[model samples]
Target: MSESRSGYILLGLSALLAFSYLMAGWGLPVEYPGTVALKASGILLLAVYAARRNAYLLAMALALSAIGDAMLALGPSRMTLGIASFGLAHILYAWIFLRVLRLRGMRGGMGYAMAGLLAVFGVAILIWLQPGMGELRVPATIYNGIIMVMAIIACLSKARWLAVIGALLFVASDSLIALDLFKDYDPAWRGPAVWISYVAAQFCLTLGLIRERP
Candidate 1:
């Protein structure tokens, strides 16, 4: 009925969908096309919530993320599309963090150190995955570089701790995906692990963007 009520309802539904999808992924034997929609549904709801809050950039980022989820779920044929979608989303996220940096005026040396560490980590990851990336190498490298910069700026911006945590979680999730896909590190736990980190990352980033002033 009221705005606050609707917000709560949407968040509750999103949480429910996320939990249900996680359980289904862990227990279910078969995945249909519908599963793509199911995987993206919770994040889509969060995107709607962001739009209602007038966080247009975050909303667009979330929507792109949802599209990426669907593309990835569609199988290897759509992998490029999935990477591109998520790559764009990361660019938007970096823009948001850059805005925060503008507002804050670059105060801390610690942030620079952290960002440097992240850059090093990104380079190492790229080196490891480069051998197996093949035709996708260039695009995947660009995407990896973008996300690493996003996470680094998120830290440097110092906008909100939740956003920082979300950025880190995102890095963890994507790193796992790359490792599994390119480095042949597939394990039974990879799917659920990636999903949990990704869902948590999106939820935190959404709330962080909504609540953050800078």
Candidate 2:
């Protein structure tokens, strides 16, 4: 296989490991070691694919994500730290998406239309269920709205199906997690779906990056 393909395969493996670790209830401390390995490996592979563009930025984003994962697994005591890490990761992702959008040029009205629709749906659902959401309702709703916008913006930047799907899946995964936080859900099933979708989203996104013109 070509080196590019090999890099994707390695990234896929790293994502798989992350999913497995989450499923096993390894928590932050136990999961940190494995996540560190996976993230480092993923960064290395992506570095090979980087050619004088936004590669370093992408690597930094993944590294931030890894740190967030570790903080989350470590336990509840580090919730603030975990949120901070993940927040930075999201910012990094936003930057990368912005770069991609600039390179591809902004899409016209259709893109904005799609984003507006997503926002409407997201906000409507949140509003309808606000009472049930309690403390998490507002924050979850706001975050989802931002992410949906980001997803749409990311999609508009490129025609790659992988990138679009990845962005959508990310929205789905986070939405599920928010629902779980606010309401009662079957943890056994919900947990796996969330992590699996999360991993898939990341894989699709990174793959899209690798496929971009250097």
Candidate 3:
């Protein structure tokens, strides 16, 4: 199929997933089948689109994200496994973003500027959540580092702004997760923000790859 047609189909799937989440009341314990399915399906569709276009880096990233969602949806007890899954996903995404930066030619000051911004925010957040991080501190720190790398490389992408936006959304979603898991923050708001930002991030990343064509 044409990229345009396939992109629309993916968009429809994203809308369906979001619509289903609303119908499901958007509550906590996002382990339900419907929620998990929605969470995975949209990104999975994007993976398929990437595969069709032979964009393996983007495809692998989305596939890992879908797996991470399923692992998380298994329940609270599986949070560790979910974290590991997402950690790997972030690593893969970082690789793709870095590759893109090299291929696109670095933006000199702008590139370093974005990386600095991401690093500062990442370090600050990790410090803020350190006390409660406790046993999971190591894993959380590594994950945050990987994601920060992805976010920084994304900023180096001038034309594929969709990917940049998606990377930032991914960072935001993880931040909400950190707050929800560590700090005694607002669950009511955090819950929805997590899912929405996640789904939107995947959508943007996938569509951005489709538009970029490689």
When sorted by lDDT, best at the front, the candidate numbers are 1, 3, 2
Best by lDDT: 1
Per-residue alpha-carbon lDDT of model 3 for 30-65, expressed as tens digits?
A: 555767786667667778878777888778887888
lDDT of 3: 0.77
Please tell me which predicted candidate would have the highest TM-score against the true structure: 1
Query: How high a TM-score does candidate 3 get?
Result: 0.87
lDDT of 2 at 198: 77
TM-score of each: 0.95, 0.73, 0.87
Taken over the whole model, the C-alpha lDDT of each candidate is: 0.90, 0.64, 0.77
For residue 83, what is the lDDT in candidate 2?
A: 57
Error of 2 at 181 (Å): 1.0
Instruction: Identify the superior model by TM-score, candidate 2 or candidate 3.
Output: 3
Query: How well does candidate 2 match the true structure in TM-score terms?
Result: 0.73
Candidate 1 residue pairs in clash (backbone atoms < 3 Å):
none
Clashes of 3: 0
Q: Write the per-residue lDDT of candidate 2 for residues 1-214, one digit (tens) a residue.
A: 9765775666666655565556456454545556545434543444444432356766666666667666665666765575566566666666677777888887667767767777777777677667676654444555555576677677667546686677778778877766665555556678778877877777777776654544
Error (Å) of candidate 1 at residue 174 is 0.2
